[model samples]
Target: MMHGRDDALDALRISDAEAQAVLRELDSVQPALPGGDGRRHRRYAYYVPGGVGLQIQGVSQTYLVRPRNISRGGIAFLHGLYLYKGTPCTLVLKTRGGERLLARGVVQQCRCVRGRIHEVRVRFVEEVDVELFVDTFAQAGDAESGPGYDGGQMLDVLDKLRDAVEDGASLDEVRKSVARLARMVAPRAPAQP
Candidate 1:
């Protein structure tokens, strides 16, 4: 069974007739992608390698998918299954910070890059938990060490530190970042005077 844009709109708690009317109105106008920019929220080069839980409406079970990138308005992921555009779906992201984020969305694009690999784009239907998205760039603390140390590659961390200086990150933020790094890399030394 294929659920289309109508099904997605239906999730908004609107009557079928009203949904049709809205669709008609939308049809009359140049369709701008949700989240603006003629296509969902501003897309960022956020490459967070993590698992995403995907559930297509009418599908009884959930699928584990790998996300390639994310934006405020949507997420793009790679999956083996093909989901038709406009299909209403649920996305559950397990952040590196150990937070689980759930969002309702509709498939916008499903492109087959190679044979069995499908790149799926989903536009969120409602507000998504921002903390989870932010967590993709940072890690949560562990019980042993309180806040966990940086899990990203050292080069990546250095790039961020360089970017902070270039982007005018507050001195306090830089100090904190440096302090965290120092704590992880250095052995017990004399305390700073």
Candidate 2:
């Protein structure tokens, strides 16, 4: 059993050099845009080995993919073959904290980056809380605030908000917490006296 786990870990591991190269490719192709990039949320690099169970042309099959990046809106990955747009797919992603999550989406686009390697983008039916998978709080160079600003506090606020909601906090009480969350995540604005 230990050997099996180790083998799985090894399969998921990507060399630093390869990871860097993938990052470079992603950056060059999808230049970060503040707003009008046609993306509703920011994408974070989240390389991992995942299974994409998809139904294409009435055939259901699962394919192994190399996860490239993820965001609240959707996820992108590298696949070995071409997948038709709008293909119904479900991704099995293992979070940083060793939790497996299933995301259902349809293939939004598929483009070839290199020989026999296709980049497939899937748009989730519902938006996801990216922090659940990637440690966005620990990430550097936040979209709103550049480097040197840590999002640890913001994450704490979010946790509190979720807990309050789950605990059946009153509307007014939740409202106040929501406001705090907005203030923390939103870009800095002029001080309000």
Candidate 3:
């Protein structure tokens, strides 16, 4: 009986190979290192299962599912809904800082598990506001305040850095550009008199 259910799930499953391959490619381009912070964060994220309203392609709809886990790059969710792979959607996340963040993401893969809900993986299409989406919710650190030192500003800097690197800028050039942007955005305090 259980085997039959498993077979049914397999029949409906969407391959995750492509998604994983993309992740690997990104990793090769920029390998993320683990930090020494004592805080324990899950490689996967699971949120309270509920129906979330999503706006996609100028249409609004509700998806019934539970967010399972999230990384800096993407998210995975327990699926019972009928979302298709490559479907573009906007996730409205209510952050701990009492702010609502809108993230544009695309469904990359989906798979069904026997006696368990299906799992859907989504990759963020646009750079997310990390401070609002990750730091606030993950309790990673205190919010920083400086000239142009907001989440949006940081994302812009990251975008510039990525583009520079893709344009064949040397590693030193990339580093210098990032440093200069950081200073411009968040200058240090003036020395005490």
Q: Rate the local accuracy (lDDT) of all candidates.
A: 0.57, 0.63, 0.50
Clashing pairs in 2: none
Per-residue C-alpha lDDT of model 3 across residues 30-95, encoded as one tens digit per residue: 332223333222232223313233444544334434444465566665544545789887665545
Pull out the clashing pairs in model 1. Answer: 33-38, 34-40, 141-147, 141-148
Better of 1 and 3 by lDDT: 1
lDDT (tens digit, per residue) of candidate 1 on 1-193: 3222222221123333443444344335522222234543433333333345777888756776656556667877666677899899987766647555678899999977455556688888874533346542233333444433334333445666789999999999789667656654544333356
Task: Sort the predicted structures by TM-score, highest score first.
Answer: 2, 1, 3
**Better candidate by TM-score, 1 or 2:** 2
lDDT of 1 at 60: 58
CA RMSD, predictions in order = 16.5, 7.9, 14.3
Off by over 4 Å in 3: 1-52, 56-60, 134-193
Those runs of model 1 whose alpha carbons end farther than 4 Å from true positions after fitting are: 1-40, 45-50, 129-131, 135-193
Better of 2 and 3 by lDDT: 2
Error of 3 at 159 (Å): 9.4
> What is the overall TM-score of model 3 with all chains considered together?
0.43
Compare candidates 1 and 3 on TM-score and give the better one: 1
Model 3 Cα displacement at 143 (Å)? 22
Q: How many backbone clashes does candidate 1 have?
A: 4
